[model samples]
Target: MQETGVKLSREIVTALVEDATAAPSMHNAQPWKFLFRPSDSVFQVYADLDRAMPHADPTTRALHLGCAAALFNLRVAAAHAGWEPVTRLLPDPADPRLLAEVALAGATAPENDLAPLYPAIHRRHTSRQPFTDEEIPRAVKDALSGAALIEGARLVFPDAWHVQTVLDLVGDAEGRDATEPAAAEELRNWTRVGAGAADAARDGVPDYAFGPRGRHGSAPVRDFAGQQSVPGRGTAVFEGTPQLAVLGTPGDRPKDWLRAGQAMERVLLQATLDGLATSLTSQALERPELRWTVRDPQSAMGFAQMVLRLGYGPSGPGTPRRPVDEVLDIE
Candidate 1:
């Protein structure tokens, strides 16, 4: 019998990879690759440097975070399939390209507690529409924060003045991006406008996922659709006061990103489970100067991984993903 599990097989690898692909990417780039070593029943995730956005993620920080998010999803799927995944991040320093290795081992049924989140995996999306004005209950906030904590990250909700300050910084970042030709060009290249050949391109934000255009008042969320000119979008007022939360870690490193990504997905999934919508804007964080301002002055959190806005509103439409076969390599 195989030592990994009572039911170890390559078929489980396929299912796990399929679920991992559902994770969110910067522009649905899905800039990740997975190799399954059936001999040891181990799966390795690799960053596809070819699909990386040179300007937005020159350091591959965002790319790493995105892939890590998928890695979390992979574990969730594996657990659901009644296997325990043992993951090691950046397993080989010499192999900088290798993101992680997840081997299916141990015969364990999915934890009763974890079973619920698996369902939320398919339901979560990056909702860009304005959330309702109603404030989220404190209990819900606590739960979401706890989810982040469980994954080795901190979730801090800013006060009113802090939230306003972050918003201003976001505005500043937008203005800079508007003036910087390179940044604007990068955004244009990745943002999808229509269902034309441009839209069919492998990487870039798609039209349907784009939020409606906003006036100068608020830093409008990236309009993947309008960025190109996709038709049939409805205009709606964005939430005047959004519940802003920051996911942070004590230090910034590749492993920190991996942990943060896992925390991020856990929080996002829990928020969805609670019927809340989330939209992430890393625009401010993209610019070094503006990114610093998003962090609360009171906390020792070193760097911010993501700026999440949560509230209630229309759920976003499902974004497309590359076929599993394109991402999974079994050997």
Candidate 2:
């Protein structure tokens, strides 16, 4: 066998990992680890089981989704660094922990100008504030739909009636979760708010991202502030009616979750690039019954993986992230 002596430099590897870490994760858990083997020039993506949110994600679906989003970012970063990332998903059947393996092939220029999206990566966040009443233009919606399709997922924008149905279902999920001691306790542990020493803590959704206490007759937005003892974390009249998109896949499986996660980030980054504000509400999708209902009856789409709200409004404050050192592993 002939040996092709191609090598991946450490600097390019570090740059790619840095961009990967910027991808969003549920509650910013960043539940992933990357192992790079220079001998074969392969980067192995692994799920950090310790960071999994067991209560909300018993099957580790959400965690896999998050890691997959990071993996996508790694590919884009590699592309920008002049390398084509050749990816293998679920490379080992027996070892389910190994999510993917990316080999660094020779560089190939991105023909379609994916460079525009590279900027929105770190800029995107889960905006909880009610978006302005202004609706997103049809063109923008179509563009985002394309983004979802590219990542092997479908974006369903519910009409007025369907939108209301989704909101109601999410409201029910929020109310039930509020009263359920186990669910509420889990939320409390992951929600960090208030000032002083503890505020410096890493992980969990911060207080700034929490917009106002629960409002009456409003779109369902997760009120992390309400879960905290401290009250009054700013207020805003959330857009009375905002566009919602349901992201779904044809099948329900681990690979589907990863695809959904990548599609979610793709849509989000495109929205950010298009000068639109966005927020995600997975409360309804968190429950199995509610999840099935969120899927558009008209489409072949299965249970929805996420519900996203889009509009023109102020960008939410930046949420803290664990330094790259914490999430990225070098080997």
Candidate 2 wrongly placed segments (more than 4 Å): 1-11, 110-113, 197-199, 214-217
lDDT against the true structure, per candidate, is 0.80, 0.79
What is the RMSD of candidate 2? 2.2
Flag regions of model 1 displaced more than 4 Å. 1-10, 109-113, 197-203, 215-220, 225-228
Error of 2 at 180 (Å): 0.8
Q: After superposition, how far is residue 110 of candidate 1 from its true place, in Å?
A: 6.8
Tens-place lDDT per residue, model 1, 3-100, is 47444466766777889988888877888999987677888999988878777677788888889999999888877777777889999999988999
In order of appearance, the predictions have TM-scores of 0.93, 0.93
Residue 8 in model 1: shift from native, Å? 4.6
Residue 195 accuracy (lDDT) in model 2: 73
Clashing pairs in 2: 130-238
lDDT of 2 by residue, 1-331 (tens): 1122447666766777878877777777788888887776788899999988767788888898889988888877776666666778888999898999888776655573455578888788777766777777888889899999998999989899999899899889988887888887777777777775236956777776676654543767777655456656555566667689999999889888888988988898899989988888888877887788899999878758888888887787777766666665566
Report the Cα lDDT for candidate 1. Answer: 0.80
Indicate which candidate wins on lDDT: 1
